[model samples]
Target chain A: MSDQEKEVTIYDIANKLNISAATVSRGLKDHPAINKNTKKKILAAAAEMGYRSNSFASNLRKKSSHIIGVIVPRLNSSFMSDVIAGIEKVVNEANYNLFISQSLESMKKEVSNAKAMFNNRVDGLMVSLAYDTSDIAHFESFINRGIPLVFFDRIYEHEKCPSIYINNYKAAYDITSHLIEQGCKRIAHISGNQLRNVYAERTRGYQQALKDNHVPFDDTLLIINDLSARAGNEAANQLLNLPVRPDGVFVANDICAISCMQAMKKQDIKIPDDIAFAGFNNDPTSCVIEPNLTTIDYKGYEMGETAARIMINHLVNNDDLQKTQSLILRSELIIRESSLKKGSKT
Target chain B: MSDQEKEVTIYDIANKLNISAATVSRGLKDHPAINKNTKKKILAAAAEMGYRSNSFASNLRKKSSHIIGVIVPRLNSSFMSDVIAGIEKVVNEANYNLFISQSLESMKKEVSNAKAMFNNRVDGLMVSLAYDTSDIAHFESFINRGIPLVFFDRIYEHEKCPSIYINNYKAAYDITSHLIEQGCKRIAHISGNQLRNVYAERTRGYQQALKDNHVPFDDTLLIINDLSARAGNEAANQLLNLPVRPDGVFVANDICAISCMQAMKKQDIKIPDDIAFAGFNNDPTSCVIEPNLTTIDYKGYEMGETAARIMINHLVNNDDLQKTQSLILRSELIIRESSLKKGSKT
Candidate 1:
């Protein structure tokens, strides 16, 4: 490339300062044997020559890049962004740089990102699996090579890989039970692809809650899609068109739930009185919507921190990754007006 | 480093396949000189041996990392997250990896992140300046070296660095003028740190709009803060405590504007009838909020794609960075019920 300039090396600094290359190298590394005055002069000459230390070359020999690679399904969500921010804070404080990429909810992109991270020789890898990542064969390379790998949020169960996530099953169960308590006999559910453990577990929880509450399990009430805002709108329309509409609805995420609620409202359906609502991932929009969305309040920042801490412990503290196979963070059912049925106990 | 295993090199794969190391390397690289059967055999053996190609070492010699570094003020915002998603898409499509970092709106963190990107030897850097970044000295090294650097959104003016942004000045002016035309004689403007050009230009635009409408500028009506939700609430309280409340309020961001409106609404103020509202960024919450919010609709994804394209063009195509020093993207005024005065023309 025309803009490419010749890289400045220690030899150039040595030549500029009329010193031996060995001495220049020792000074640049701040070796104890190097004289203080010579070291200062060598540093000054190195800066003047615009010599950037070859960390990549040295890291190759050391077998440690001091770089953490993060792959998420997407970055446009408030929860994911919060998670990233938390990871960034911890990673930065530990003096490790981050290489972040998104899978865009595609397993194909996830594989390519994993390959790139592996080729780049990241010290450790953190991932939130994509929607359709049925098999994690792409991450086998990291495992075979003993490179630390940690999964967060939408995770996979692997003997070698430690995962950090909230109890999606129990959270869904609690929210569903809450809806049942609000006198909802028939509750609709909106979820994402069942290939993802998060969505699958949530579905199981919803089914279990209905069974425990003595509510009949209706397969027709369960709408499965990508759980996008558009999907939520479609799901809402589908539910509204049904002969007997549900009295309550629980969505996999707040974005979709809010959109679903908006669509229902456009049809002149009243919230809570008409159909109580609950969603997961208490995103920022949960409160902005009229009547406010009742959702699961799980801290993405905490999840990110926990996952990064696990990676750091394995990479820095030499902690055994196998010792911590899975960690479940706390999640709460945040009751809001959207799910509060009229005349129900406060 | 007990978990650290011996790196499987080309020699290991060659030894396993009883082939020359040179042949193995060529086969792995898909060299046309190598037989297809030999290439397939080499790949299988490499995978079996868990051999990862050392791109970092090769990049060190080539003076190209095939990595693009991105630093933004923060990642938690919907706008920023969208921008990151867009950047990731383009960078991945171009077969380049992204090293992403957030400054958290702190100049100190921005400088440190810049240093990390520099040390990591990224081929190009994309940045959105931090809130308190008073100087561009940290970026001097990138400019000094022939590394292509591009800025987007919250940008800085530099002869060497190309920037991609929307016309914040005109967007702000248009929205302010729209409010003025709705008979809002006394309008308040909420802004952010003046050190950043986006906020400064917006403030200037608001002021010029008022002047053009023959409305006297009131310094007391101006509120400058971080433009966070909490700050917006505080600004609302401050405005309410004023001797005279503004007929309309324009916030530099949607999160703050939504929060400000919510705070005012809680105090028994009727929106549009009592005080018209307008915001920038057109965040998702803007639509979810009651009455909807009048705002500037600028595509963060488009801005991100433009910035990444610029960096890729310079790094991959050998295009002159100076040729596209500043690129202004399109933005529109989205008028909604929040800014529509009663009895005004539809």
Candidate 2:
């Protein structure tokens, strides 16, 4: 058969199932409104028929480039860079190129970047939403076009586009549990843009873990701020001004954690002795900091590689991948001297 | 007059000078074979006639959808990302998108990436050459046309493209003098890819400073290793085995310096007490490390911003910036507790 002859059309599946082209197309992609039995029948028929969608032809007609567009909150961030490096290595090996853009933490910029990528006609997309991005309408164009999209780190609750990320809930719970195990009664939490899913999940983790341990969660201990050195300094100021000082701290990122350490040092508060500390993402800063920060070893590179492969696999091999989309990776915790208030133990 | 009518053409200059068009063209661009007086005469005649050349037509024919291609060594590194962020901000504001590609330390991959960028027809090119990238001939495709090119950080010696960078030699000299002023008798240097101009200049600075200080320089004191954390850790092993221990240490990058510190700590060596340490690039690792690192702050963002502006100025404002090909920026040394060993008693 010719390459075009091998190309699957909605009609091929319809004919095999003795159904309309429209129904086959909708059912193969798992339309929520489709009847359960009919949807299953259509999917099974399409798979059995060995249908190969003419992605290139369809993309060309719709001005879709089969390129996966990615908009990271920022580019130079250590975590983001590692993830991207992973994605690049995977996608390049598969002959797919990612069109990456940076939102730089502004909703206006995020919207503009999304619009630009939409116009560029990427077949599918993956995103780590911006800090202040409340409404996800900017992504409506792709969702409406039946384009598959996924989110990681900072996710959006979109029905059409599934998200793939680590078990932030469990990871945070583990970190908090470890802190509590070390006998931290009054623990402070320094977080990133609360508008993000990663931070929200972490907050929930901290609260739940506190509840589980029978420790009353105090609102005063929660400091909502940007996970930056400057913000960490400001957070330190607030921590010092508090009527009752906290015994431990858990920062969302390593930079913030290290900054808080510096700020605390300025106030003559020694780390791991006056106030034990913990940070997320086993960054270079974790090792650089004295008493070496204890952190959750989040595999940023693996996340990127997996996400890139997911996009490429759907484009090249599996037609049903877009329908069943969420991928979850595991994050591990490494205890170090910073959190070891009791005799050095995990 | 029309745009072309106002343009300087070799034919018009030749007509006025009663010389060959080739001679006029060669003289305008300052070809080496052309006589100095004849070149000056052609230049004067071209100015008087307002003769236009191929630059305008060439640019119009090669419009690349206003995309600026960036080929970096790696995206995750502290310095590379800073430069990229600056480049992205400047270009995004100017309505140009960046297509970023990482070489991943492979010369073959770098070649293919260059080809892809060329085929994609990026309006202009911004590059920081890879570790082992000696032949920049892949860029000839852009130069074959009239594409505006700019290089920042890493560069080749014999290029006419506008290069925006810092005076590596002077910065290295300043830092070396600083070590000397701190009453350092023996200083060991850790270096990176020796073929690179940045490393070469730093090595040169280290040698010159020792000579000028009337201190006998030892060949055994210089260690050439890839400036990586793993490499730095291994270098520590070599340092311990040395017959004579050095009092002052200068590593090429912060990651390496911190790793060296980690290794020294394992060997029961105290930082700033047993040995003073300094590094290049004011990476966040410097701040995170205990006794905070004293090092050179290579301003990546400033370099990126300046490089973008230079290219855009040449592109939009009709300026021939190649006359001033090499642009240098300022670098500063940030001293923290690490190098504060010899105090006010000095």
- The C-alpha lDDT values of all candidates are 0.91, 0.78
Interface RMSD of 2: 14.1
Question: Which CAPRI tier for candidate 1?
Answer: medium
Question: Residue A35 of candidate 1: its Cα lDDT?
Answer: 94
Clashes of each: 0, 7
lDDT of 2 by residue, A150-220 (tens): 78778887766667788877888999998899988889998877778899888889889999998889999
Local accuracy of candidate 2 as per-residue lDDT tens digits, B215-326: 7788787888878899889888888788988877888788898888789978988777767888999997887777789999989888888888777776667678677588
Worst 10 residues of 2 chain B by lDDT: B55-64
Q: What is the lDDT of residue B38 in candidate 2?
A: 99
Q: Highest lDDT: which candidate?
A: 1
Expressed as tens digits, the lDDT of each residue in A1-346 for candidate 1 is 4434778888888888898999999998999999999999998887666678877777767878889999999988899999998998888888788889999899999999999999988999999999989899999999998988999989989999998998999999999999999999999999999988899999999999999999999999999998889999999999999999999999999989999999999999999899999999999899999899999999998888888988887888989999998999999999999989888966
User: What digit string (tens of lDDT, one per residue) describes model 1 on residues B55-125?
Assistant: 87888778788989999988888999999989989998998988888998899999989988888888899
Which residue pairs overlap in candidate 1's backbone? Answer: none
